[model samples]
Target: MNTKPRQTGRGGPRGTKNLPPAPDNKENIDTQILRLEQLEQKFNVEGSNTLDIVYARQENDQHHATIQAQAAELERLKEIVASFHASEGALGPNITPSGSAAAGSTQDAPKKDKARKHSAAANVDDMALDERASKGQIGAESQPSGKKGKAPKPSAPTNVDDMAIDAPDGAAAVAGTGADDEGVSDTTAALARENAELKRLLAAAQAGPVGGPAEEGPAPGSIPRPKGSAGSDFNIQDAMGLGHGRKNRKNYKSIMRSCRDLVLQARIDWERPWAEVSAATKSKAFAVAEERHPILARFFNSWATEELMKQSVKNKRNRAYKHDGLEVPEKYAYLKANAAKRNPTAPRGRQAKLGRVDVARKRAEKKKKVATSSIKTKKDAKGKGKAVAPESDEDDVEMKQYAPSEEDESDCTY
Candidate 1:
């Protein structure tokens, strides 16, 4: 309680300057433990936080890895699916199951491994079963229930004639019996013999009196024969056109020659009608014309005679008037008139006749005028003392006015 300051040697009270350190006691230990515990707790908290971070990182890594693995697996599955679809497309819709199963095994490795062994064993068993079944079916179908399962006995051969006799009608069972056999049988033998005898008689009749005496030469009383014994020669002139009456023969030859000429002319001038042939060859030989040759006769018949006649008339009409530039001739006019009578639509015949007459009169007038002009020119030249006079019809009239000359002879030919 006294407020006095107690003086000590150094900083604090102690047993001595070198006194031994305080013994570590429970308290101290406890305190130190407490501190250690606190430190440990702190360390644990920090460690726990660090561990949590590490664990979180590890979890994140594991999650990412798992995702990657899943992605790879998905890709692999996609590839497998695509391959499966491709295989299905290649094989037809009803492809055998064994083929598909085998293909599928390649994509699903583990499953395929197991399936391969199983399929092989199954195939073996199936093959054996199939063999047994085939054998059984064959035996059942082909063999009969006899001693030791042998085949049935075949029937014995039967005589075809006997079978034919027993047949109802038209059965193949008796077809092997030939008609010759039937002919030789008792039923047909007599008829066949009679047929042979009739055939012999027919052949004998066809021979035509073989055993008769040789035909003698015609008796002296027979009709008189030609000098050549009348053997092979015979007159065929009657059969041919040559044997016709003289007029008919001449007409035929003329027609034939004309036809030949027409054909030749047609060949030479392709536009010439066959009808003009008769006129062209009027003076030619029938044989030379060759138009009536046997080969050409067919062509003539095909081109009917009436058509040829029409063509001839047309050619004649053209030749008669076309050269002079005049109207058609009388023959053509007559034809036209007849045609008009047959067909009322034709032009009038009077017009054609008038045209022809006008053309003829005009031609005559032109010729007379030419002659008169020539005579007038000659007389004018003579009067002018330039040339001698032309002796013509007009001069004759002028000369009549002058004295007649004794030397002029009317009987003299010009």
Candidate 2:
């Protein structure tokens, strides 16, 4: 508001002219502030999506580890069951209801041998008592010799359990194991069978859907009747889509690998309660998909799948997709490669196949090492006297570089 100009030194403003130029640090601070502002703007727009991707990756890794552990546990259980069956088989064919050696002409010989052992043991005990008495280790009144006029009644066990233990090993073995074996074997067999069935279902679930034409009744006498009807003719390979006439080995490998991830995700999600599928769960599921197969990750997320399911569900009231009950997609329908390779005769993308992940650099390096090991072995053989260096500790060995190909934006949903 001042109309009069302020008077200063010859440079116009003396204090301003003398002031030092802005420091390098001050310019850097300003640049950093601007970058931070831009970053904050980005976070406001895409924060949810970014967070979801991270969560999904973690879920996928955890799922894979769990499935691997389960498979190992199942294998161990099978081994235990097998050992039980073998031991039961080897227990000898002469087992009786009481679990004792069967009563036959051969049984008398064992009884005779046991009687001799008892008499020998009794004589040894008598000898020990006489020696103890002579040495004044026992009181004369307690000596067996003092009661010589009457034969000592054989010592009897006070309890049934004691009597069982006192019996011949063969007799006790039979008595203890006979009934228990039947019951235990029955229970174990049933449990093993159930576990096997469950494993089969899990493996099947991870594979592609079964493919076969509906079976019609066979003509009269067209085939011999089996004792039992085969409920489902499909095998695991058929379920895995390997039953196709022309095989694409690459595609098969790809499907198998992706199927493992899908199965793992399904397992983790399926265990949680269906009612708990809120925004958080939805975000997690989306993130997990994005972490692995970014191309199809969005398709399996809550928003995408829920929208897809709305039209498919019989009841409109049940609009939400059950997070835990997700199934592996039938085909890799979303992939550009799969879509391009589809048969012209069939609907576009309908018959699309799964695409394999690009082979990683570490895997390629491993293959190279394997190939070169033979040459090294030949050299070692030719120079037997040459001192070879001890191998470096595995801890000190450099780990291979690994880079997984990220899916391009062609498959992006949003």
Global lDDT of each candidate: 0.42, 0.42
| Per-residue lDDT over 160-183 for candidate 1, one digit per residue giving the tens place of the 0 to 100 score | 334345543322221113442232
Q: Which clashing pairs does model 2 show?
A: 52-287, 56-287, 56-288, 99-174, 100-174, 269-324, 270-324
lDDT of 2 by residue, 85-131 (tens): 56544543444322234445434586633333222222322333344
lDDT of 2 at 310: 23
- Minimum summed lDDT over a 10-residue window in model 2 is located at 348-357
Model 1 scores a TM of 0.15
* Model 2 / residue 158 / CA error / Å: 47
Q: Top TM-score: which candidate number?
A: 2
Tell how far residue 314 is off in model 2, in angstroms.
42
